[model samples]
Structures are given as structure tokens and as C-alpha cells.
Target: MKSVTRSLRVLEAVAQHQPVTVGELTKLFGLPKSTVQRTLVTLAEAGWLRANRKDTTRWEIGARVLAVRPAALQGSSLFAAAREPMIRLRDQVNETIHLSVPDALHSMVVVDRVDCAHAVRTFHAIGDTSPLHATATGHAVLAHLAKSELDEFTAGTLKEYGEETITDPGELRAELRRVKDRGYAVNHNQYLQGVCAIAAPVLDGDGVPLAAVAASLPESRFASGLLPELGRMVTDTAAEITARHPR
Candidate 1:
């Protein structure tokens, strides 16, 4: 059990200051070089740490660390909050419901989702990253960000996922402006062809965007004339979720 305790301590140390070398870990923990080396090797083999690609001499926490963290677990609660609402919305609109939150960087991570009962329902895996510009959820959240933050995100070149994906930053900015005014976002075959999504921001305790709630369906299922009603369903569902959040 002593080795296990030492291993956990080493993991905690690495997690706190990643990309650490053997010497740094030894110095930080006041352990011998051999002890730190053995512990690090064991932790790395267990999928807790990953050797840096650029500098193989150093190690950082692995993606598996994301699964064990408290924040990731807490994020799953967003699904719990949306379960009944999602079911209700899915039944009402006969569409799939997706719940997503911002990940470490530019991507929006899908935390939870429910698929429609139909065979042709839209399907997405949990923990998958969606493009911020091409997804309905992404637009809803980005539309609410501060100008400085939004500028920083859009400064880099964006990849074109589909023909309908917005490559022009200026046009995207205008679309975000429209989303801000309407309090909802729409993706018409922007990310995936044949699918359309409507999204709205789920606010935090202080009314900041915490996540986004979206309803996605095959274009064939919803007619163009029903766009306004579809937008309203997403916006109203997100509002219901925000009201449940404790301020």
C-alpha cells in the first residue's frame, strides 16, 4: 500500500505541474531519482501520464485524467438536469437532443445526449468534440462570449468541415450577432449534411453561458416553414434549464 500511496502522490504532483521531468519530480517530492523514475514509469503505464511528444524527457497527464477529474463528473450532471426536459423536447419535436460544454480549448465537447426513437435519428457520441463555428451549440455559446474572447477564438484560421461551413470570419461574426439578437442559433447542414440543429445557451448562476442545449433532426423531418417553431423549442428548453440553475 505504501507504493500505491507514493504513486498517487506522484500523480497528484504531476497533475499539478505537468510536463515535469524526472529530476523535477524528484526535487518537488524530495524523493530519490530512482524512486521517482519507477513511480513515473508505473503511472505512465497505467495511463495516468503521457510522455511529451516534443520532449520525450518530460511527462504530462494523459487524456484519461479527464475521465477521473471531479469537473468531468460534475459536467455529467448537466445531463441529469436535462434528462426530463430532453425527453419532453424529443417527444414534442421527434428529434435528438444534445448537451455540450466548452472543452480545454476551441472545441465544444459533447457531454451528454439522447437520440430519437426513429431509425434515422441523428446520433453523436458523448465526449466527442464539435467544431465551434459549424455546430448550432457552438454558435449559441460563442454569440454570448465577450468581444475580446471571441476575437481571440476567431483569430486563427478555421477548418472547412462541410461546403456549408462558414469559412469567412466576418460572415461568422455577423451570424453570431444575429444569434445574439435572437437568443438562438441554427445550423442548416453546416456540420453534417442532411441534419439541421437549433441551439440556445444554458446560462450559469450569474447568467453566463455554462453550456448549450440543442435539438437536431434530419432536414427531411422538419420543413423550412417550421424553422421559427423549431428555434422557439430550443430557446424555451434552454431557458427552462437556466432557471433551474442555482444563482
Candidate 2:
């Protein structure tokens, strides 16, 4: 039990400060250097972290952690409900399609994705995380959260990833309101430079958000003229997923 507890602490530290060195983990945990080193070795052997080749003394999360997440997500009814619809949407718009769930307070994690055929396109694998403050999917999910949850979520710090990110709490609330009214959310080069996206919520039986769906493309291809047409396709796909999976 003690060993298990220590291992969890080490994992949390690595997750909080990844690509960190053993010496840094020791200082962060106030543990003996030897203990931190041993913990890091155990984590590496167990496929939780991998030492960096450029500097063997430093480590970052390994493939197993990412691989393990998608299996559980696939078992979810939401993922099952959203998969085919995502494929159809991707085919219709020929843009990168993403499906995410609000698994944490400040971000959503991608559980499934359909890559765009474009040679140059935005891409994120399953289990990748995106910040709530600066993404279209994040805004769509946030707009549909219960009022109490929304209040708690907004009370935290909002990171500004780009010039277009909505950092002020008041302004974020206003944006959420607009998103709710419009039935979808738009992110125009807000999270990443030259990337634009539109997203809509997949709702549960009570009409609260269960997940979100998005279509992303490079700003060079956004062609503002298509926003209205494409936005509806994205929302309609989300609505279809919501209807199939009410849980």
C-alpha cells in the first residue's frame, strides 16, 4: 500500500511537470534523490514514463499511458454513438473531425478522431487534451454545462494561448451565452495559430452536455464563406449523436 501510494505521487508529479529530470522531481517532492530515482525507474518500467533520449536523465509520459486511455473510452456508449456520425461529417466536409468529453474541469480530452484528407491539416490523437478557454469544442461543452458547474469551472484561471483567446471571466461568460444562443461555438485562430474550428454539444437526456463534436481546418482553408453551411453540418451531427445516446 505504501509503495502504491508513493508511485501515484510520482506519477502525478510527472504529469504536472513532464519532461522533468529526476533531480527536479526530488526537489518538487522533498524526497531523497535516491527515492525519486527509484520511483522514476519503476514508473518507466511500468510504461508510465519514458526517459528522453536526448537527455536520459529527463523523462516524459510514454505511449502506454495514451494507449491505455482509448480502450476504456471505446467501451463508452457515447463513443459508440458518435463514431459513425463523425465519419459521415468528415466525409461531408472533408475536414478533421474530433469527438471529446469534458473529463476534467478545465479541459476536454479527445476520445475519437477522423483525420482530414488534406495533406496539411490539424490533427490530434485520442486522449489528447485541449484547454476549455481557447477552443471551439471547449466553448460548446462549457456553454451546455449546468449553471453551478459552469460557475465553478469559470472561477479558475483561464490561460491565454493566443491573441484571440477569451481570458476575462466576464467576457467568457458572454461568449458562452452567445454560443448557447447560436447553437454552436466558433474558434477563429484562438487556441493555435492559423487553426480555426466550429463545435457543437452532444447532449444527454436532461439536455446537458455529454460530449462535443468539432470540425477543424487551417485558417487558410476556413474561407469564412463556408462557416454557415459547415456549422450546421457539425451541429446536426452532434444532434444525431445526442439522440442515439441519452446517457
Model 1 misplaced stretches (Cα beyond 4 Å): 1-77
Residue 205 error, candidate 2, Å: 1.2
lDDT of 2 by residue, 126-243 (tens): 6678898799999999998888988998898888888899999999999999999989999998899999999999998888887899999999888778878988999999999998
Q: After superposition, how far is residue 245 of candidate 1 from its true place, in Å?
A: 1.4
Q: For each candidate in the order shown, give its overall lDDT on alpha carbons.
A: 0.84, 0.88
- Residue 227 of candidate 1: its Cα lDDT? 76
Clash tally, candidates in order:
0, 0
Scored by TM-score, the top model is 2
Which 10 successive residues of model 1 have the least lDDT summed? 68-77
Return the number of clashes found in candidate 2.
Answer: 0
- TM-score of every model versus the real structure: 0.71, 0.88
lDDT of 1 by residue, 1-247 (tens): 9999999889877865778899998889898999999988888888899899999999888877866654654566565577678778888887899888876347787777878888888888766678898999999999988888889888988789789999899989999999989989999889988988899999887666889999988878867788788889889899888876655
Q: What TM-score would candidate 2 get against the native? A: 0.88
